[model samples]
Target: MCLYFLDCWLRTERYYELDDGDLALFESKREAFLKKYEKEIKAYRTERLIGSGTLRDYNFSSLPENILKNLDSYPPFNGYVYQNGILCARIKIEDKYFYLPPIYDEDCR
Candidate 1:
């Protein structure tokens, strides 16, 4: 699996800084949400957030305080590696989960 350390732009109000335990909880919830509405979430993201509609070079540190720092402990992130991977963001709408780069690896997580 390929892991890219990216500048991720997470929604503050939606997803706050999650510690180790909280991160696990969030991932479990996210997995369940995906199993149910993955297709719908994919459709929304493909139409609105990726490809032609995507936002590149987005400032990922727009979150408040050390939120970003805490989120870095999540999967597929190993701190910033000077890799300019375009915007990585995760948000949920109407009880549906959506993300730009879907399916992250937890190998070295």
Candidate 2:
């Protein structure tokens, strides 16, 4: 199983929020955030590497309290937050599973 954080906004909202009717135009937001968040996450990985820490070993425990609490207002949602070397979100349709962007294009396999 992926060592995932299931309830994170900066880390999960843009994708999972796509199904939330209260959020308008989430599809576009999801795409935009996917690119933006991936770059940000990659940067975090670099930061960790420079400090002698591997990306996969990093954890969210040291993040600020506010940053960790950003998802409080959104409806509760859960999924693999870190997997395949980046964040991921998935949905199922017609018995077929699909990822929001497939982080590393794992879905193409």
Candidate 3:
């Protein structure tokens, strides 16, 4: 289960990269991406709580707010990265780190 989440997180990081830094564009793209992968995301959330005694359905729509609320709790690190005509940023959610507009390389496996 941990591995699955890690994989998804990594994939999201890679997928989040944007060629332009327009946040409105990013939000639109993010929404579309989430909607397209809604089923998989739900399954991931469900598996995440398998043994945690909490069965409440997780809402991805609230992710941005949730991330913002917990942003200061973690150590500050350089979140933004610009490379290969794309820009990305690292974001934290709970203990996990996610890249917004994720870093990517064609050579990456």
Query: Which 10-residue window in model 2 sums to the lowest lDDT?
Result: 46-55
Candidate 1 residue 40 Cα shift, in angstroms, is: 32
lDDT of 1 by residue, 1-109 (tens): 0112223563211111224654565477877645543433433222122221222322334544444566543323222221234334454333433343322223312
Best by lDDT: 3
Tens-digit per-residue lDDT, 1-109, candidate 3? 1113344334321222223433455466888755644544443432112221111221223346756565444333334455454333444554775544321223322
lDDT (tens digit, per residue) of candidate 2 on 1-109: 1112324443322222123432333354766544544533333222212111122232333334654466233222234455545443333333433333232222322
Question: What are the clashing pairs of model 1?
Answer: none
Residue 76 local lDDT, model 1? 32
Superposed by TM-score, candidate 1 places the C-alpha of residue 81 at a distance from the truth, in angstroms, of 28
Which ranking of candidates, highest TM-score first? 3, 2, 1
Candidate 2: which pairs clash? Answer: none
TM-score per candidate, chains pooled: 0.18, 0.22, 0.22
lDDT of 2: 0.33
